[model samples]
Target: MPIFLEAKLLVWLSPLHRESWLWACPELEEKPYAIVPSPIDPSQFYDMKLPREGVICVTSLFEFKGRKNVLQWARDHPGQEITCAGGNPLPNEPLPPNCRDVGQISPWQVNETYNKHKAFLHLPATPQPFDRTVSEAYLAGCDIIGNKLIGALSYDWFKSREEVAEHCGNSSKLFWEKIEEVLND
Candidate 1:
């Protein structure tokens, strides 16, 4: 913890993450910090514009990822089919009948998965510094349905597809620019 405190600047993935950190380490309020989100290549995901419907969750089935919430959502929406694409379920954790686990798929398959669904659901039990899947799902033309824990949703870009893509395209440059500024100081 002391080693981490020695840093000149702390770059956070989102405002929510920054706030969370500040809450935990109030003393760090005196330190320099920046909010720079992770980038998502727009090319890797595209809106197929198919007749999309239902919901899909692209998250690992772990407790921290909100495996319990996922199950609850499936149970709540008995009529709605919730397709999940991720593996590593905690032992003895079975998904509800409406929730179908497609297991873990390659990154290439994620775009296709989003295309098939109208909405993307992400409800992590704990706060995620940033969940790139939310941005990727949005880029693929899926409506994002997530809780406040998803750090990406706290940013303005998450509201519009164009803004999301633009941010993704510029994120790398922005990150480096921040780094340069920190080094120059």
Candidate 2:
């Protein structure tokens, strides 16, 4: 049996995933499906008084998450500090001097890290379903930079990492609106 037939509603984190599903099972197009990006509750994040600084990357220390790319980016930008918050470094993989590994952090801690960082970096080896961290970082007012395969949303179309901060202010509200549209449908 097709899984779509068994579900009341199908929610996809990205349009790419939804399109792929419909392409694979064209019959499922009749089913109710929504392309809703991941959500982040603003209340969970702290608003910082100090100016944000440095570049921050949050992902598991796995190779697929593009840890090497982030390390390389850190090395390339010698003057800027880069902080990584996620699972510990892989065995025998030492972080670059410009990059500081914070290991794994709680959601709240991630919010704080976003509050402090000037930019967020993510370079996945494969396309991401929907990176919740992108939304969280936007809500925390950090500039976004990295893989174009992050999601189906407009943020993925951001012109540049440096310009991403300008779009951050309204993302949280838009995120909720999309969720409401999905739920109401």
Leading candidate by TM-score: 1
Please report, in order, the local distance difference test score of every candidate based on alpha carbons.
Answer: 0.85, 0.68
Q: Estimate each model's TM-score.
A: 0.95, 0.71
lDDT of 1 by residue, 75-151 (tens): 88899888888875663666788878887888778898899999998899988998999898999999877899999
The reply for model 2, stretches above 4 Å from the true place, is 4-8, 20-31, 152-185
Q: Write the per-residue lDDT of candidate 2 for residues 53-163, one digit (tens) a residue.
A: 998888835677776777777778889898888875584677778878877787557777788899888876656667777766766677778766576234454444333
How large is the C-alpha RMSD of every model relative to the true structure? 1.3, 5.0
TM-score of 1: 0.95
Cα lDDT of candidate 2 equals 0.68
